[model samples]
Target: MKTLAIVGAGPGLGLSLAKTFGQHDFRVALIARNQEKLDTYMQQLREMHVEAAGFSADVLHTAQLEAALARVKETFGPVDVLEYSPTPSITDVASVLDVAPENAQFQFDYIVRGALAGVRAVLPDMLAKGDGGLIFTMGGASITPTPMMGNVGIAMAGLRNYVSNLHEVLKPKGIYAGTMSVMGWFKNTDETPARIAASIYEMYEQREQGEHVFEV
Candidate 1:
């Protein structure tokens, strides 16, 4: 069976992505840092009759993340699709001036670095196969910077640029790279997650070249 590896399998969009792909008969390999939480989620997938497993790993550390990916491959087969959607704590920014230089690196680490690690983990196999999907769940701050989210805005702006450029570079190599930019608050409603997941699958099927914006 084919595999869909979600690097940040949490209760919201991550789990939604799991089920969305799983419904289409994709075996799921969920990756996250919390074993207990992931185990719960894995059980839920089984209850739904989806072939699934969970692996614990932190994206900040390359070794741990790569190891988890290796195990996923060993268990379910090479990951046909990779979703990177790690949520980071946002530091409020009242103004553009409020964003400190020292804090910039931390923001970059949260979004850019984490997403790249997941891509790097699976890209080689995708390239070898001559096909794969890599999707990032970014947000509105990356699209239109506002005073309230100045800090996160600037940081996500960097991530937005990186994902866009990477998409261009990877597309020719038969890898579809894209980001789903959410512009509004994500409520924990069943419809929203399912809708977003279905949209993501559509984007992948279309091999979208850049960010797919979801505005309020």
Candidate 2:
């Protein structure tokens, strides 16, 4: 079975993604910083009858992230799909970010470079085979710039640019690259995760390359 590796896997959209692809026979690989959390996610996928495994690695470290992907490939075979969902380390994230602009680098490291590591780990093989899929969970700060999100918005903006560039360059090379830009209130829209997951699957099915925007 093909493998789908979800970096920064967590409870909400991550679990929805796991279920959506796992139910369709994709070997789900849960990648996260917490092994215990990964274990829980693994159990949940197993309960749902999905072949799944847990992996732990700090996304900020490219070497560690690449190593984790290598291990996944060794165990489950080449990753057919890569889902990157990065979270900022800063808890009290605010719109006015110049107060501690340095924090923005952390976001860039995890969100942008972290994603690059995953892509580099799998791109060669995909290039050789001439097909691949890359999906990103993005924020509203990317498409619409707000002064309040200056810190994270900087990194998010970079991520958005990279996603667009990658789509332009690699789509013709058979890599399906896109972003799920969440601009809505996820808490109020409980079903948004499922909808996003389904939309991701549809994008892959159609080999679509572009931004898939949603409020959730």
Off by over 4 Å in 1: 91-95
> What overall lDDT goes with each candidate model?
0.83, 0.84
* CA lDDT for candidate 2: 0.84
Best by lDDT: 2
lDDT by residue (tens digit), candidate 1, 1-216 = 679999878988888888988898899998999999999999999999998999999877878888999999899888899998887755434356776875666667767788777888888899999899888887788887677776667778887788888899989898888888888886756578778888898898899557798764
Candidate 1 residue pairs in backbone clash? none
Q: For model 2, give the 10-residue run with minimal summed lDDT.
A: 90-99
Candidate 1: C-alpha RMSD to true structure equals 1.9
Q: What's the lDDT for residue 3 in model 1?
A: 93
Q: Estimate each model's TM-score.
A: 0.92, 0.93
Q: Please give the RMSD of candidate 2 to the true structure.
A: 1.8
